[model samples]
Target: MTRCRYCNRPLRSARSIALGYGPTCRARALAEARAKVIAQHKPTTIERAQELIEDGGIVPLRGNRVWRVVSTDGSTTHKTAGQVHAWTAGLRGRHTCYHRVAAQLVALAA
Candidate 1:
């Protein structure tokens, strides 16, 4: 017999040993830990951009020779003719977005 380090409950069966907590206590603790991890690493601007582009949820609109990519979240990136030309030339087979560009730059560094 052993007591759970977290809940101080008597652990007798294999199931209890595996959980190391009473069922209710184990579930609550797991939920709390998951929330903490999520809160710690909330999505960044670049991350949100990558997600939008990867999902094909951004639409590119052209006006007066300028290009703009708009996301459903109302985020928009305006590009000059030169900037758009350079981006298309450099993108090759990879995806491109003003938001995702920063994220991809970070990912490459990593």
Candidate 2:
């Protein structure tokens, strides 16, 4: 007798025997797989930007409507417009980065 992979119950049908899972267990396993995929998605850029602010990586330049943001790795610095909330070091041509997002958050809080 073939056994279900999930519940370990005997499989009576030919299709179920080949698939290794009974219909109910197969559906449950698929749903669990989908949920795991959703939960494992990569974190968004905004979260990194938020971390920068929390780490005191953002600073206001004196006598100007500009802010300075440090890179996450501390290898570079970028300037952002205080009012417009745009940064220089962007990923591709998106014209936005964690620095930009951090600037926007600071602007909002002020």
Candidate 3:
């Protein structure tokens, strides 16, 4: 007897047998896949954002006060505005903002 790949139950319906999983299992699988896609589109961290900028993967949007960054994983995540949080570079407690980091990156390249 053919078994459902997901629920591991004996396949009863011809459609379920052909698909290898029951309707409920199929629905669960689809929901999980969608959730994974959504999770992959979450906001990126400052370090990841810097790497994206250096690799030319994204351009910071010009804003009045702060900058914005999107997910580096190539997903359509919403643009996350800069939090003005300072990041330490090898030094404890010492930190700077994205604007300063951008300038530093440019200076390093030039």
Candidate 4:
């Protein structure tokens, strides 16, 4: 017997058999679409960067790097920020930052 694509139950209705998903699944899909439409759009990390300054704070681009910032100065500049964060997280030391300005930025963000 042909099964419902959604619930995997044996399809009883002629329409449910033709279309892959059952009536319940179709309703669920519609509700999900509507919820997405109604939900507020959240900005990504990069996009939210601008708002950081508007609230009267030390902005990332303008603010100095944390005293604890990990060096990427000469050689490591080729690496991405994520790579730098990962590298710093691995090191065992005091004052070593997970990012160029992470220590300072965290204080600023909070």
Best by lDDT: 2
Instruction: Give the winner by TM-score: 1 or 2.
Output: 2
Global fold similarity of model 1 (TM-score): 0.37
Q: Which stretches of candidate 4 lie over 4 Å from their true place?
A: 37-110
lDDT of 4 by residue, 26-84 (tens): 66755665444224322342233233324332223323432222243423321212113
Estimate every model's Cα lDDT from 0 to 1: 0.49, 0.68, 0.49, 0.42
- Candidate 1 vs candidate 4: which has greater lDDT? 1
Candidate 1 local lDDT, 44-78, one digit each (tens): 64566456556654334443234344444666543
Q: What would the per-residue lDDT of candidate 3 be over residues 1-110, giving only the tens digit for each residue?
A: 99978778898998998878798988786677545433443233345445656766434455323334333355543332233423334134244333334333332332
TM-scores of the models, in the given order? 0.37, 0.48, 0.37, 0.29
Shift of residue 46 alpha carbon in model 2, Å: 1.4
Candidate 1 regions exceeding 4 Å error are 44-110
How do the residues 1-110 of candidate 2 rate in per-residue lDDT, one tens digit apiece? 88998999999998898878898998887777645433433357567767888999989885335788786679987777533444433534444565666665565454
Cand. 3 Cα-lDDT: 0.49
